[model samples]
Target: MEEMKRVLKETVDRLFQEMNGRFVRLNEIDEKFGFLLDLKGLIYDEKDYDLKKKCNELGQFYVSDIDGNELDE
Candidate 1:
Protein backbone atom coordinates (compact mmCIF):
# COMPACT_ATOMS: atom_id res chain seq x y z
CA MET A 1 0.00 0.00 0.00
CA GLU A 2 2.82 2.38 0.88
CA GLU A 3 4.58 1.44 -2.32
CA MET A 4 1.43 2.02 -4.33
CA LYS A 5 0.99 5.45 -2.76
CA ARG A 6 4.61 6.31 -3.45
CA VAL A 7 4.27 5.24 -7.08
CA LEU A 8 1.04 7.13 -7.53
CA LYS A 9 2.56 10.28 -6.05
CA GLU A 10 5.64 9.96 -8.22
CA THR A 11 3.56 9.42 -11.35
CA VAL A 12 1.36 12.41 -10.63
CA ASP A 13 4.37 14.56 -9.86
CA ARG A 14 6.06 13.53 -13.07
CA LEU A 15 2.93 14.32 -15.06
CA PHE A 16 2.68 17.72 -13.41
CA GLN A 17 6.30 18.43 -14.20
CA GLU A 18 5.77 17.40 -17.78
CA MET A 19 2.69 19.57 -18.09
CA ASN A 20 4.45 22.59 -16.53
CA GLY A 21 5.73 23.57 -19.97
CA ARG A 22 2.31 23.43 -21.58
CA PHE A 23 -0.49 25.98 -21.55
CA VAL A 24 -2.77 24.60 -18.84
CA ARG A 25 -5.72 26.42 -17.30
CA LEU A 26 -6.26 26.77 -13.55
CA ASN A 27 -9.82 25.46 -13.58
CA GLU A 28 -8.69 22.45 -15.57
CA ILE A 29 -6.24 21.68 -12.80
CA ASP A 30 -8.95 22.14 -10.20
CA GLU A 31 -11.25 19.72 -12.02
CA LYS A 32 -8.53 17.13 -12.29
CA PHE A 33 -7.68 17.37 -8.58
CA GLY A 34 -11.35 17.18 -7.70
CA PHE A 35 -11.69 13.94 -9.61
CA LEU A 36 -8.61 12.57 -7.87
CA LEU A 37 -9.95 13.59 -4.47
CA ASP A 38 -13.24 11.83 -5.10
CA LEU A 39 -11.42 8.66 -5.98
CA LYS A 40 -9.21 9.05 -2.91
CA GLY A 41 -12.26 9.38 -0.70
CA LEU A 42 -13.73 6.19 -2.13
CA ILE A 43 -10.44 4.36 -1.70
CA TYR A 44 -9.94 5.45 1.91
CA ASP A 45 -13.56 4.81 2.87
CA GLU A 46 -13.98 8.43 3.92
CA LYS A 47 -17.69 7.72 4.14
CA ASP A 48 -20.44 5.62 2.65
CA TYR A 49 -20.27 6.98 -0.88
CA ASP A 50 -23.12 6.53 -3.31
CA LEU A 51 -23.92 7.82 -6.77
CA LYS A 52 -27.10 9.66 -5.78
CA LYS A 53 -25.57 11.27 -2.70
CA LYS A 54 -22.46 12.24 -4.62
CA CYS A 55 -24.48 13.64 -7.47
CA ASN A 56 -26.46 15.76 -5.05
CA GLU A 57 -23.23 17.10 -3.65
CA LEU A 58 -21.83 17.76 -7.07
CA GLY A 59 -20.88 21.39 -7.76
CA GLN A 60 -21.69 22.13 -4.11
CA PHE A 61 -17.90 22.09 -3.55
CA TYR A 62 -17.57 18.33 -3.40
CA VAL A 63 -17.15 15.97 -6.35
CA SER A 64 -16.94 17.34 -9.86
CA ASP A 65 -17.01 15.66 -13.26
CA ILE A 66 -15.11 12.45 -13.55
CA ASP A 67 -14.11 12.64 -17.23
CA GLY A 68 -15.42 15.83 -18.69
CA ASN A 69 -13.72 19.00 -19.87
CA GLU A 70 -14.34 22.25 -18.07
CA LEU A 71 -16.84 24.47 -19.83
CA ASP A 72 -16.02 28.00 -20.84
CA GLU A 73 -17.45 30.76 -18.74
Candidate 2:
Protein backbone atom coordinates (compact mmCIF):
# COMPACT_ATOMS: atom_id res chain seq x y z
CA MET A 1 0.00 0.00 0.00
CA GLU A 2 2.80 2.40 0.89
CA GLU A 3 4.59 1.66 -2.38
CA MET A 4 1.40 2.14 -4.31
CA LYS A 5 0.85 5.47 -2.64
CA ARG A 6 4.43 6.53 -3.38
CA VAL A 7 4.02 5.58 -7.01
CA LEU A 8 0.78 7.46 -7.25
CA LYS A 9 2.35 10.56 -5.72
CA GLU A 10 5.29 10.40 -8.07
CA THR A 11 3.02 9.94 -11.05
CA VAL A 12 0.91 12.91 -10.04
CA ASP A 13 3.98 15.06 -9.49
CA ARG A 14 5.37 14.13 -12.91
CA LEU A 15 2.07 14.90 -14.58
CA PHE A 16 1.86 18.27 -12.88
CA GLN A 17 5.42 19.13 -13.90
CA GLU A 18 4.67 18.14 -17.49
CA MET A 19 1.57 20.32 -17.47
CA ASN A 20 3.56 23.27 -16.15
CA GLY A 21 6.14 22.87 -18.90
CA ARG A 22 3.40 22.73 -21.53
CA PHE A 23 1.86 25.89 -20.07
CA VAL A 24 5.14 27.74 -20.40
CA ARG A 25 5.28 26.77 -24.05
CA LEU A 26 1.63 27.68 -24.43
CA ASN A 27 2.39 31.15 -23.08
CA GLU A 28 5.06 31.57 -25.71
CA ILE A 29 2.66 30.51 -28.45
CA ASP A 30 -0.01 32.85 -27.05
CA GLU A 31 2.44 35.73 -27.17
CA LYS A 32 3.46 34.84 -30.69
CA PHE A 33 -0.17 34.88 -31.86
CA GLY A 34 -1.39 37.66 -29.51
CA PHE A 35 -3.67 35.30 -27.58
CA LEU A 36 -4.24 36.63 -24.08
CA LEU A 37 -1.35 38.99 -24.84
CA ASP A 38 -3.07 41.84 -23.06
CA LEU A 39 -4.83 40.94 -19.80
CA LYS A 40 -5.48 44.53 -18.78
CA GLY A 41 -9.02 44.46 -20.25
CA LEU A 42 -11.51 41.94 -21.48
CA ILE A 43 -10.75 42.76 -25.13
CA TYR A 44 -7.69 43.38 -27.24
CA ASP A 45 -6.15 46.75 -28.15
CA GLU A 46 -7.60 49.02 -30.87
CA LYS A 47 -4.54 48.99 -33.09
CA ASP A 48 -4.97 45.29 -33.70
CA TYR A 49 -7.94 45.93 -35.97
CA ASP A 50 -8.00 47.08 -39.55
CA LEU A 51 -11.38 48.76 -39.43
CA LYS A 52 -13.83 50.03 -36.82
CA LYS A 53 -17.14 48.21 -37.16
CA LYS A 54 -19.00 50.61 -34.89
CA CYS A 55 -18.61 54.26 -34.02
CA ASN A 56 -18.70 53.45 -30.32
CA GLU A 57 -16.25 50.57 -30.66
CA LEU A 58 -13.23 51.13 -28.43
CA GLY A 59 -10.67 48.86 -30.11
CA GLN A 60 -9.48 49.11 -33.70
CA PHE A 61 -9.10 45.39 -34.19
CA TYR A 62 -12.53 44.60 -32.85
CA VAL A 63 -13.23 42.25 -35.77
CA SER A 64 -10.36 39.89 -36.42
CA ASP A 65 -9.44 36.27 -37.11
CA ILE A 66 -7.59 33.70 -35.05
CA ASP A 67 -4.25 35.17 -36.14
CA GLY A 68 -5.41 38.70 -35.23
CA ASN A 69 -5.82 39.72 -38.86
CA GLU A 70 -8.53 42.34 -39.31
CA LEU A 71 -11.54 41.58 -41.46
CA ASP A 72 -11.85 43.13 -44.91
CA GLU A 73 -14.76 45.36 -45.75
Q: TM-score, each model?
A: 0.30, 0.49
Runs in model 2 deviating more than 4 A are 35-73
The C-alpha RMSD in Å for every predicted model, in order, reads 14.4, 8.7
Expressed as tens digits, the lDDT of each residue in 1-73 for candidate 1 is 9999999999999999878745356666655345446766656655564534443444344435431223211
The candidate maximizing TM-score is 2
Question: What is candidate 2's lDDT per residue for 24-73, written digit by digit as tens?
Answer: 99886664444333443325445654233332232333334322233211
TM-score of 2: 0.49
Question: Please, what is the whole-model Cα lDDT of each candidate in the order they appear?
Answer: 0.54, 0.52
Task: Report how far residue 17 has shifted in candidate 1, in Å.
Answer: 0.5
